[model samples]
Target chain A: DVKVTQSSRYLVKRTGEKVFLECVQDMDHENMFWYRQDPGLGLRLIYFSYDVKMKEKGDIPEGYSVSREKKERFSLILESASTNQTSMYLCASRRAVETQYFGPGTRLLVL
Target chain B: DQQVKQNSPSLSVQEGRISILNCDYTNSMFDYFLWYKKYPAEGPTFLISISSIKDKNEDGRFTVFLNKSAKHLSLHIVPSQPGDSAVYFCAASALMGAQKLVFGQGTRLTINP
Candidate 1:
């Protein structure tokens, strides 16, 4: 079975603080993605990395960035956390246009 | 502009009844359509999928019907169970290789026993 793990299931950070949400997939998938889920807004992609050191901005990439240093791990970085940035952060990894296996998700609360 | 739309915010059905969740997409170029089920605090899970070439796909009690002319698709769950209650999100991908999916707002499904 493929397993996708996130660094934190729930996190609380103060305003202006820098936040890092990590995601790791054991399947060695080539494509990884980061998305933020909000009520009534569905899942909006923040960024996606198709290969190591390669990344592309998605629908809502503002105020967020991602790092894919290694193939198995992808990291989402919040340069400066703000209240509006608080939401359910989900990470996913897929291979060859197949179903994207997702992590449990990180619920970030920016205060 | 929303490409994928799930007009129904929520739906309720009794056990052993049928639950129909609808989704519509504006982009005619979309070639792949998928459904995902999500629980509270958990990531969305793959439910079922249909290719543009096929009009219907079925897996157990779940059946997905696609109407290309209407730019719409629907997921039908027969004999709905309480365990099936979750947030159903409809997604579409235009290009096969460019697998970025546009998702709908999602419909909360509740099964009353």
Candidate 2:
């Protein structure tokens, strides 16, 4: 089974604090993505990496960044957390043009 | 502008009845479409997908129909069960877009007993 695992299922952070969410995939997929789900907004991509050490900004990437140091893992960073950044973060990995597999998701609450 | 849109914010259907959810896209470059089901506090799961070349694709009780001319698609669930209650999102991707998927606003589906 293709499995994607996130570092935390839920997180709470104070305003202006730095936050990092990690995701790991066991399927050796070459593409990984980070998305935030908001009410009435569905899932909007924050960032995506097609290869190690390579990253591209998505539709809603202003407040987020991503890193892919290794093939199996991707990380999303919020330089300074704000209440507007509170959301359900999802990580997805796909191989070539195949369907994406998602992690359980991390619900972050920025206070 | 929203490239992908799910007109209905929510839908309610009784058990054993067919549930239909609709999606529309404005980007003509999108040639691939997909449907995902998400439960509260959980990541969206892949439900079904249909390529622009084909009009229909079915998996078990879930069937997806695509209309390329209209830039629209629909998902039909037969004999909807309580477990099928979830938010349904439609996504589209173009060959040039690589792996990035543009998603719809999503429709909340409720299955009543």
Candidate 3:
């Protein structure tokens, strides 16, 4: 079975602070993605990496950045955490197919 | 523009009854569609999928129906159980190799005994 693990299940950060959410996949999938889910807004893509050191901006990439230094790990960075940034963040990995395996997700609270 | 849309925000069904969830897409380019189920604190799980070439795909108790002309799809669950209660998301991909998915707002399902 494929396993995707997130660094934290829940997190709290003060405004203007820097925050990092990490995700690792054992499947060695080539594509990884970060998405923020909000009520009525759905799961909006923040960033995605197709390969090591390769990144692309999704529909809502503002206030978010991602890093993929290795094939198994992907990190999402919040440059300056704000209250509006609080959301349920999800990480997913796939192998060049429409099927994606997702991590448990991190519930972020920016106060 | 929202490419994928789930018009109903929530649905309630009695146990042992059938549950039908609908999804519509505005992008005709999408060739792959998927259904995902998510719990409160967990990420969405891949439930089932259907290709544009086929009209129906079934997996045990879950069945997915696609209408190419209407650009719509529906998921049907027979004898719905309480365990099936969750948020269901509909997603679409233009190409299988791209691995980029556009998702809908999702519909919450509740089952009563």
Q: What DockQ does each listed candidate score?
A: 0.80, 0.83, 0.85
**Measured by TM-score, how close is model 2 to the native structure?**
0.98
lDDT for each residue of candidate 1 in B1-113, tens digit (9 for 90 to 100): 99999999999999999999999999999988999999999999999999899999999999999999999999999989999999999999875566788899999999999
Candidate 1 CAPRI assessment class: high
lDDT accuracy of residue A60 in candidate 2: 88
lDDT by residue for model 2 over B1-113, one digit each (tens)? 89999999999999999999999999999988999999998889999998888999999999999999899999999989999999999999986667788899999999999
User: Model 3 TM-score?
Assistant: 0.98
Tens-digit lDDT track for model 2 on A38-106? 999988999999999999988889988888999999999999999999999999998876788899999
Docking class of 3: high
Once fitted onto the true fold, the runs of candidate 1 whose alpha carbons sit more than 4 angstroms away are none
In order, the Cα lDDT scores of the candidates are: 0.94, 0.94, 0.95
Note each model's CA RMSD in angstroms. Answer: 0.9, 0.8, 0.9
- Which pairs in model 2 have colliding backbones? none
Error of 2 at A31 (Å): 0.9
Model 2: DockQ score: 0.83
Please write out the lDDT profile of model 1 over residues A1-110, one tens digit for every residue. Answer: 99999999999999999999999999989999999999999999999999999999999999988899999999999999999999999999988667878899999999
